[model samples]
Target: MKLAVVGGGSTYTPELIDGFARLRDTLPVEELVLVDPAAERLELVGGLARRIFARQGHGGRIVTTSDLDAGIEGADAVLLQLRVGGQAAREQDETWPLECGCVGQETTGAGGLAKALRTVPVVLDIAERVRRTNPGAWIIDFTNPVGIVTRALLEAGHKAVGLCNVAIGFQRKFAGMLGVAPVDVHLDHVGLNHLTWETGVRLGGPEDENVLPKLLAEHGDAVAADLRMPRDVLDRLGVVPSYYLRYYYAHDEVVREQRTKPSRAAEVAEMERELLKMYGDPELAEKPALLGKRGGAYYSEAAVDLAASLLGAGGSPYQVVNTYNKGTLPFLPDDAVIEVQAAVGKSGPHPLPVPSVDPLYAGLMANVTAYEDLALQAALHGGRDRVFRALLAHPLVGQYAYADALTDQLIAHNREHLAWA
Candidate 1:
């Protein structure tokens, strides 16, 4: 199989290569292409990718290109990991929201909405080119604002499925806590991407043998600590919320904390410099330990499994993925993209039946779903009013004054990318 990574110049690519090398049997890649615009970073990342494959004794050849079409042409699958604007833009996304007293994040809050606007058009163009070259190829998107991006891909009629490491990360953690293999643990992970909850963690796949209560009883502090939420909140909610929720449940506190710390984008920018330096080294054969702190933990395994499953290279029947709601939540529109455990195979992911959602989670999910609708509207057909409306609908920026201020800041920061503005 030929597989293409659209943002292979990224420092994160080697970690993906590590997974591809280790799970070589699962994906059976014969030609791997790394596509990116940054030639210097591409060479560095490409060299390291080849070394990683060779060190793992894999036969697949690694190719690097700045030409998106050339890199993706005839590939069996294309993974979209591109950042439309690099960390410089992300720095702006992470910084200016503090001016409005809202959480500034790359994949949540106003920043995530900014990412969605910048991303959807670029991704659609690539998807169209991929379709022209390899109509049968599956597009596995690992982009931020995945819910919005995946929705755009599907709406534009691309053969695509959004992937993220968050679910796999949770499964790995829950398994470690339960003293079981990661494969043996199944999470009832549901909601939009980045805004999800682990309603259940089952020992058996797709079975209702929930051990979440046991986990909470024995490791409440640990679980709560991981989420950076108080143990009492978990006890009250009876389910684990994604760390992103902190921006909602403790908005003012998070904004205050963010104001005190250097932007994560700045930290990651520095980390990327160190990583690129390492990638340029001829002797470094394995993914560096420092890469772990850069985020997207377990991304490789998640990407490989999702890609393989979509291509009918079957293993586990159930994997958590971002796909249509299809009435899984009942409260949200069927077309809304949600991340949930699904039976993935050749036909694509069929979301497993979800338990009835509690009002607390469902209500917020519905609200966000509405906000995402407007967010995409603003993305597709750019207008200040639409952007303002989306921000107003967002639970994080519900007030008119904040929405007005955020809309102006978002547009100002993103004007270069927004053609209509």
Candidate 2:
């Protein structure tokens, strides 16, 4: 099948390639199209994809293009992974609000809303082009403010599903924290990207009932077992967990400690810069790592892995993403593309409906819904007040009027970026 990766020039392209490479035998990718605005980066990913396929002794057509239309034409699946304004824009997204005495984080709070407002228009353009070019193609979107962009794509009447490695990665990590096999620990995951929580987790066996809360009661052991443990997420879900919780729950405590608060967003930008420098001249670098890793990398085995899984080359269940929750989950407005667990095959992705989230995470769901509504309003209407109301409704901004002031200030300060003052 023809699978096209839009924004294939991104630094994360390698990880995706790595992810798919390991699945090549099952997915048996027939053709791969890498689309991006940067010709050099597109060439890099395309070159990597071709090399990975050959190393595995698989023959697949790999094509790179700057033309979006050319890449989407007759595609069976399209992966959207673009950064509309790049890290520079994200830096602005984070820094601009900080300058106005507001919390500055991309894909959350005021900064995330601003980022969404700016990005949705651009993402929709890509979706529109894909729709016009390949009516049957399913768009696998991985853009930040994913909840916003995915909803916009669906609202604009496009076939698309949002994707994020964060959620599933965290799910598996939490399972590890609980000392259970990842597959055996079934969870009820909900909420928006990055802000989501696992409301329930249980051992898949017969001893399922009450295991999650019992495990959570042993917080000390869980924390010691995994420093990366997201105890806060667990606490929120009222269970044991790992990952973003280390920072998310400690936000207030970290500030009290006078230490550098954990910021994956800042780290993401810095790593991108370092990797771009390394990729600029692989000869000067010791080992190259893409995504969050540093150095010692192969051409990447991920893309092939995905291809293998798609072609049905495995016995175990493969994690392939399919869009679910369009009509089922009322928490998110209809058309918000939610990335959930799915089994992939020749028939494509079949989504798994996780259990409903808790009331705490339900608040986050409400925030994403607000962001989605605001993104749509920003796209279809030019009302800054509407955007303001959305921001006001956000949990982050609920107690911080400064966030609102910052939002207003940002629009005035960066009128060109917001397309209004």
Candidate 3:
């Protein structure tokens, strides 16, 4: 099968290459194309990719190019990992929100809104081109604000599925803690992307016994520590919340911490510099250990599994993915994209049935779904009012003053990206 990576020049690409090399039997890619506008970075990353593949004795052909159309032409699958304005824009997204006493995160609040607006247009154009070049190709989006981006693709009538590493990361960690293989542990992971909860941890299959209570009783402290939340909070909630939920559960405290530290974007920028330097070395045949600290842990494995299943190759039958709700949650609209466990195959992901959601988490999910709805509107048809309305609706920025201030800052920082600005 031919597979194309749209942002293969990124420092994160080698980790993906490592997975592709290791899991060749899962998604036997015949021709792999790396598409990026940055010629220098593409060459550096592409060279390392080939070396990694050769080191693992995979026979796939590796190609690199700046032309998106040419790179994806006739490919069976196109993966979208592009960043519209690069890390410079991300820096702005991570810092400006703190000015409003809000969390400066890349996938939530004002920062996420800015990213959605900048990213949606570019991704749509790419999807349109992919449709024209290869109508049968599947689009796997690993882009930030995945819920919004995936919704855009599906609404535009393209075959797409959203992938994230959160569920896989959780599964691996839980398995190591439980002294079991990763495949034997199944998570009842549900909610929207980045805003999800592990309602249950089952063994063997979706209908198997739930071991979540045992895990909490024995390892709640460690889980809480990893999430930077108090152990008592987990006890009170009776469920494990994703680290992203910390932004909501402790908004003011998170804002204070964010204000004191350098933005994550800045730290990642420095890490990318070092990672690119490491990628240039001819002797480096494996992904560097430093890449682990660069984040997106287990992203490659998640991508490979999702891509393989979508292309009718072998992959895990049930996995967590972002797809249409279709009444899985009575509270959410049918078209709302949610992250949940699903039976994945060539047709697409069919989200497994979920138990009734507690009012607390369901309320928040409904609220954010509304915010996402407005965010998509602002992205598709740009205007100052729509942006302001979306910000006002967000649970993080519900106040009129903060929404007004954030809207101005978002527009000012992103004027070059927003054609209507």
Highest-TM-score candidate: 3
Sort order, lDDT high to low: 3, 1, 2
Give all candidates' CA lDDT scores: 0.92, 0.61, 0.96
Which candidate would rank higher by TM-score, 2 or 3?
Answer: 3
Q: Which ten residues in a row have the lowest lDDT in candidate 3?
A: 75-84
What would the TM-scores of all predictions be?
0.99, 0.78, 0.99
lDDT of the structure predicted as candidate 2? 0.61
Candidate 1, 1-421: lDDT as tens digits: 8999999999999999999999988989999999999999999999999999999999999999999989998898999999988999999999898898888988888898899899888888899999999899999999989999999999998889998888899899989999999999999998889899999999887775899999999999998998888999999999988888888898999999989999999999999999999998999999999999999999999999988888887657899899998888888998999999999988888999998999989999999999999999989999999999998999887889999999899889898999999
The positional error of residue 207 in candidate 3, measured at the CA in angstroms, is 0.4
Residue pairs with backbone atoms closer than 3 Å in model 1 (clashes): none
TM-score of 2: 0.78
| Alpha-carbon deviation at 241 in model 1, angstroms | 1.0
lDDT of 2 by residue, 1-421 (tens): 7888878888767666555556665565677788898897676556655665565566777888998888889887787777766766666666555544445666766777777777787788887888788877777677777767777777787766565565455446657667777667655555555655555556673236645676567654555356444445445546533343433555445333323443445667788777666555533312244444631122133234333444456523544243545654567655455555555555555655556655655565666666667656865565667767777666555544764686576576446656555
Predict model 3's lDDT versus the native: 0.96
Please list all clashing residue pairs in model 3, or write none if there are none: none
